[model samples]
Target: MNHAWIDGRPGSEPEAVAAAAALIGGSRLPVVTGLATDIAGIRAALGLARIAGAVIDHQASAAIYPAVTAIRDSGMMIGAPAEIRRRADRVLIVGDAFATSPDLPDFLFRHEPDLGKATRGKREIRWLGGPESSADIPGAIEPVVCPADGIADALAMIRAAAAGHRFGEGPIAGEQAEAVAAWMKEAGFGCAIFAVAGMDELAIEMLAGLVFDLNAETRFTSLPLFGPGQAFGAALAATWTTGFPLRVGFGRGFADHDPDLHEAGQLIASGEADLAIHVSGLAGAASPEPEWSGRLPVIAIGGGAASWANPPKIRFDAAMAGRDHDGVLHNERFGSFVPFAATQTGTLPRAADLLAAIAAALGDVTTGAAA
Candidate 1:
C-alpha cells in the first residue's frame, strides 16, 4: 500500500489516519462532501459523519437540485433509460441532452434490431430549445429555438396547447405548438429527456408538467440524465440511513436536512465549517475543489492525483470504488441496487477502509481525552 500524506509530506498510513482523526475530532463544525464513491463508501461516510457530527453533501447536488425539487414539488412521471429505449416512439428533448450522456443517440436511435422490440412506427425526436447540433440523430425535428431562459415559457405554451388552453403569443409559434400537440395526441409511448445540469428549476417543473399533461391523452414520462458517479447512489444511501436526502447535518446530535442552509458550498463559503473530508473514489470521478478563503483544514480520500487550488491538509490516494474494489451501486435505469465487481486489483486502500480507520482513530482519541 502507498503512504498517505500530511501537508505534502509522506507518512505511514497509521500516522496519516491518526492525524486526520485529530483534525476532525477537535473541529467544532466538520463537513463531509464530494460524496462520489460507491454504496459501501457512502455508508462509511455516513457513519463517519454521525461520529464526527458533520454535514454531508454531494459535489453535484447543486446541479441535481432542479430535478429533485421538480420531483418533490409536483411529482414526476419518470421512466428508466431502458424503458425509454424499449417503448418510447416519440422523444421530446428539452435541451442538449448529449452534454450529460453522449451515448444518448445510440440509446435512442441505434440500428440494432435484436436489441429490443422495435416501435411499431418510426421514432420521432424533437428539440425545444437551442440550435440543433451535429450530435442530433437522423430524423430529428427542431420546431423552436428558444433561449435557455425561455424554455419555461416555451414549455408552458406546449402544455397549454396540449391542454386545449390559450397561451397567447408565446415564444413558440402557434403552428409549431399545434404540431407538437398533434404529436402528443398521436404518440403511443412518449418520453421527455433533459439534463439536470444547465437546466433551471422552473424549466424542469414545466417539463414535468408537460409530461403530466400529455399523460391525460397518451402515455408519457420523463427521464433525467445521470452520469457515471455516486451522486445518485449517495442520495439514495442518505435517504435510507438518515431518512433525508443530502445536505444533512448531524451537528444537532441528530440528522437534520436542509438543502439550502446546510449545502456544502454555502457552509464552506460562509466559514461555518472549520474542517472538511472529501471522499470521491469512483472510477473517472473528479475530485471537488471547494472555494473558500478561510483556509479551512481538509482531509481528502479519493483516487487520482491530488491537485487542488488550495491543497488539503491530509490526502490519501484511495482505490477506485468499482474498478479497484467491489461494491453495490444504484442502477438509475432500473431503480435498484446492482452488484459492481472489481475490475482491477492494486495496493491502494479503498475509501471504506480508510474511513473506518479514521473513525477508529478518532474513537481512540476521544477515549484517551475522557480518561
Candidate 2:
C-alpha cells in the first residue's frame, strides 16, 4: 500500500523521501515543527534537523513557553500529580485548567487524599478563574469567576493577603482576599493547579509567587497542566540530543537556542526558513496553518497530514504512537516516561522510520541518543 504522496498523488515511499530530502538539502534554511510524536519519532526528527541545518520547534510552543519561561525566570515549587493527589487537602485551580486536561477533575476529586484518618477531611477545591459549571466536577467546588486576563491581578491580591501586606486594590479585594488568605493559612497541604495554554508568563509567575507565599506558612506547591501535543516528550528528546529545548537552530553547525529568533512560525512567516518539515504522529492532530504551507514549501509527515485542508507539497502517512504502534511516551499522570503497548497492529509506516529514511536520503548519517 502506498503511504506516501507527492502533490497529493500516491507515490513510492523512496520517491517521496528523496523529494523531501532534495527540498531540505536545496533550501538555505529549513524548519522542523509540529513535533507531536513519541520519543523515538522526536529524536529522529531532531537528527534530521541536525543534518539539514534546520530549526526545530513544537506546535504547542506558544502554550508551553509560559510555564517554561516562568520556571526559568523565577524558580517554582513544583509537585508531581501523584504527590498532589495523595497529600493535597486544598486544590486551587487557576484559569480553565480542566479545558485541556479533562482527567484532572476526576483525578483530584474521585476520592479524598489517603494520608490518614487524621487528615482525611473533605478536600476544599477552589477555582481562581474556572468554569461556571460544577456538574462535571465531583464534590463541592468554589468557582471564583473573574475576567480571563485578570488572573494575574487576582493572584497578586491573594499573595498579598496571604503575606499580611496589602498590595493595593485589584480584581480580588477586601473580604474575598481575606477569606482566601484565611483558607490558605488553614490548609496543611495545598496545590495550585494551572494550565499553560492561554496563560501569560506574568500570570504563571504570579501563581508561583502565591505558591511560595503559601509555602512560607504551610506546605504548598504548583502543578502546571501539559498536553494536546506530546510536547513534554518532544522537549525531552530535543534537550537530550541538542542540549537545548525547542526553538533551536543548527545553522551554525551546532545547536543554538533563541526563543524569539528561532520561533518556527516567525521564521516561516518572515521567509527566513525556505522549507518546512512538519512531523506529527498523534491521532486527530490538527494540520499546520494554511499560511505556513502557503508561504513556503512544506513536507508533512505522519497521520496528522490527513487533517490538512490544502495538501502540502509532499506528505507521508505514518503510524500513530500508542495506537497504531507500540511506543514510549511521557505519561503526565505518572510524571515519567512509560512504555505503551499498541492496541491493534497497524499497517501504516512508523514516523521514526520515515524520518530516518529522509535523513539518510540527505546523504548524512544520523545517530539517536537514548531519551
The lDDT of each candidate is 0.80, 0.82
Error of 2 at 318 (Å): 0.7
In angstroms, the error of model 1 at 200 is 0.8
lDDT of 2 by residue, 202-319 (tens): 9999888888877777888888877767886677677778877788999999999888999999998887888899887876566455457678878988865656666788999999
Candidate 1's error at 30, in angstroms?
Answer: 0.5
> What is the per-residue lDDT of model 1 for residues 104-173, given as tens digits with 9 covering 90 to 100?
6675556422223225676777887845564456565654577777788888888888888977887778
TM-score for each predicted model, relative to the true structure = 0.91, 0.91
**Local lDDT at 156 for model 2:** 82
